[model samples]
Target chain A: MSAAVPSMPGTRRFALLRHGRLLTGAILTGALVAVALLSLLWTPEVPTRLRILAKLKPPLSEGLLGTDQLGRDILSLLMVGTANSLSIAVAAVVLGAATGTLIGIVAAMRRGALDALLMRMMDAVFAFPPILSAMMLSALLGSGRLNATVAIGLFTVPVFARLARADTKRILRRDYILAARGAGKNAARIAVDHVLPNIAGAILVQVTIQLGLAILTESGLGFLGLSISPPAPSLGRMLADAQTYLTLAPWMALAPGITIALIVAGFNLLGDGLRDRLDVRRDVSA
Target chain B: MSPLLDIRGLSKRHPPRGFGRGAGVLALDDISLTVEAGSIHGLVGESGSGKSTLARIVMGFDRPDSGTVLLGGVDVQSASGEALTKVRRQMQMVFQDPGGSLDPRQRIWKTVAEPMGLLEPRLARLQRREKVDALLASVGLQPADGDRFPHEFSGGQRQRIAIARALSTNASLIIADEPTSALDLIVQAQVLNLLMDLQETRGLAILFISHDLAVVAALADTVSILHRGRIVETGRTGEVFARPQSAVTAALLEQDAVSLASTDQLKEKIHYPR
Candidate 1:
């Protein structure tokens, strides 16, 4: 029960280390989002308008990044593609994390038969990989951004469920939780007031990491021609289109490819940094 | 007048783990005790003596196999939903670990006001804050101390915060399970004195559970000595301490005497840095 007072100097140094990673990740992630938002206002040329005369122009030509096989500006396509990819990733992560966390909390609180059932069902969902599930849904629902989002989001349900369930179970065992119950607080009230607030740090770290994974999943589906149909300028679809013209136009493939990698890295770094900062026990030991 | 808290013929057995067919270990054996209004009934025993099991049952946290717990003559064991909650609000617990009892992430005021928030959901936030401040003051803590977290306080301060929380509901009965076992000797004395003061001022009935015979002897009026899920002896604290009938009670009193003598010697030799 004795509270361990962490040394201020040690904690301040650790904070600096964690902040370094967070800052880098934030900057990279911010720049990509800014590009995507800016694309909503203006791009060098219309992303889908094909000018046959300027086909396959290299970098620093008619547009900043050049033109694609159809003469649609590569820079414009990259920007618009980022917006599409980001929107899908954000929606999928939000949907998956929110629903999954709710299920997890319920499962942990109503432990025993209900807990076993919910967890087993989540295991069933976990069996299917994100891209495979997205492809199957795309086949049934037909290829579109909405279908892609649902598939990727559903795929992430088990991840959040497992994390949320474990964290909730741990919090449920804490003395304060028992005290809360003893104070006449019901299960639902305790779940909201006590359980959720304590586990939120872990859940947030999971969400950031999942955002990166969702983006990757959507892009993989698009690469396989099962996500966000052609002419709308998705990052994955652009990569797929560039496959045939790789030798003739490498930038067509490289532009979207590098952008996807940077964004994913950004999210991952941010998640790691957050996990370190928020969990004081881990922070002190490390 | 009926006792403020009454427990009768309560028995609980944990179901055998795994796929076994045998009966489980009996945690409590028809345990019965009562706390009269404005008095302290101490349940003293060694570890695994069913002290905590009885406490949990009295709080309605665990269901008893055979007995009924009556709070103000209401059968708490039979109550459900809102009825259970209503009965629960009349009785609260002060847990063993003071530091762990209060939420580390929450401010002292929020932790103190949590019970009131649950029981009186319609109370204004400002009003609740004022009430929490008053509760802190009652527990010998400054009103401004409510703004800090549990980690910012010493072990004794955290226990005071917990005592404030227990009093938040204006509960008639407070079940304190070894409330000061975790503190240093000086802090332990302070917390015990505070509990005694609160009991006198609030007319609060207390079920004080502990393994330490000396501490319980000092605070509790009536003492029940439990051994291996059964009450070995029960009587007024002074009579039992002076003339222990059961071997378990005699051994506990002897051990406590030895520990007290040794602690006195140690205290003289050791000076703890403040």
Candidate 2:
């Protein structure tokens, strides 16, 4: 039950399959994940191999999508970059959501002094500008995707915590929760049977939104040379390397730029669509 | 045996708003009552007459400032662990708003089976399922109806589901706090009739709380009239109405006179506009 509601499984799937926003988002995000997973198998050419003679050769002149300033295949680099970008986002969001949701549930259940202290701490965490702190965090931790993911994950804590805690508190006041208690279920039992299920929809929506944010933030770090060094490739790093060439080679930025835009938009659409579906059902039941 | 349920010297004060300074409102003032086994004890009161506060205290959802609630000779206020569980199992409750009481997210069977699940954990899963079906049937609902959600039911059906849940644990006493207040006239009579039937069949006791004297007068064996936070008059239903000693009781009788027929009003000194 989501406080006491069971998971909305198959019912939403077929109905939502016909939805434009959800379909487009599913296709785009699905493509992103598929491309990332596909990277393990193949790419057009060796992404790290530098063809000195083919440097700045532009699209279609040689390999498809042409080459970067270093003469590496842009298509291959983009293919590998999806894996790098997605892994960082997924890992960071999962870590943050799990930790933050637990803290939020605890804060709500405990209430009083502990709740005040926990919520105030979350407020403090929220006050810190996410991008700047993530920048400093990755920079201090040295170079690597883990450093950036960890940094982004840490900052995401407050958002999920606030969401979970607020939802739990609201659902706790419901007569069913009281009825559950009267039925001989303890505080923890009600939390598992009622609180978690009811708060889940909100949490799921937040997680989707945060996945997009994490990707954006981690890319920002990579743009600053904080993640995915050398041949590993990163979309943000590709954009960074392309910026210098600018007028000389505008096509260098196109591939990575378009990919990032599509992925972020995909996540936003999916989150919004899920929220709409949840709202409609809630109104019906209400 | 002592009464199935008993409350002695129960008191509660709702603290004032904002920093909680100054004197608080006395929601219940040293109230005491008893519900004999297989009898209906109606708590009659106006809107602010501490009916809900006393219900909460007796249900052990909220602690009384000073009092002891004995359910079958066990002190509910201080019972803990297994004793607490037993107290919870023996004394079940039905709320005013059936919609609010049943979890909209849960299926009817699960809600009805919850108390049984807790109290009879050792019973086989299949046996529990059978029990749930039996409980649903006992409430005049089809067993298949148990698969549906609360949103799928009418107000009367929801109240029936709530009653089914109360009966699931084989509770000796059901604290029905305004169980019919949210229902329409016909449905209220049906649910009251259902309660009377359940008490008849199971030999259970009921602490029926309500704001309407006519409703109480029709069902309760014993009645207590509460005003503000104190019980102004109480006795066998017939005796109390025959001679109301308190002005508050007189007012309740007068207010409830609207529902009574012209003939009955002559003896009670009440007149109904035809």
The CAPRI quality class of candidate 1 comes to acceptable
Off by over 4 Å in 1: A1-15, A282-286, B81-86, B117-119, B262-274
Across residues A145-177, which tens digit of lDDT does each residue of candidate 1 receive?
899999999988889999999988987777788
In the range B1-274, model 2's lDDT, one tens digit per residue, is: 7888888988898988789798889988889888899999999998988998898888888998898999989999889989989999988899888877877677888888888855877888688879999999999999899889888888888999999999988999999999988887777777887888898889889999998777777778999988889988889987898799899898778877785443243323321111
| Model 1: pairs clashing at backbone N, Cα or C within 3 Å | none
TM-score to true structure, per model:
0.92, 0.91
> Scoring each candidate complex against the real one, what DockQ results?
0.42, 0.36
**Cα DockQ of the candidate 1 complex:** 0.42
Question: Which TM-score value belongs to model 2?
Answer: 0.91
lDDT of 2 by residue, A1-286 (tens): 4655455665576566648777787788999999999997999988899988889878999678889998999999999998999999999999999989988999999999999999899888888776677667756876787787877888899999999998888888777777788888888888888788778888988988898888888778788888767669999899999999989988889989898888899998888877876655531222
Best by lDDT: 1
Steric overlap count per candidate:
0, 8
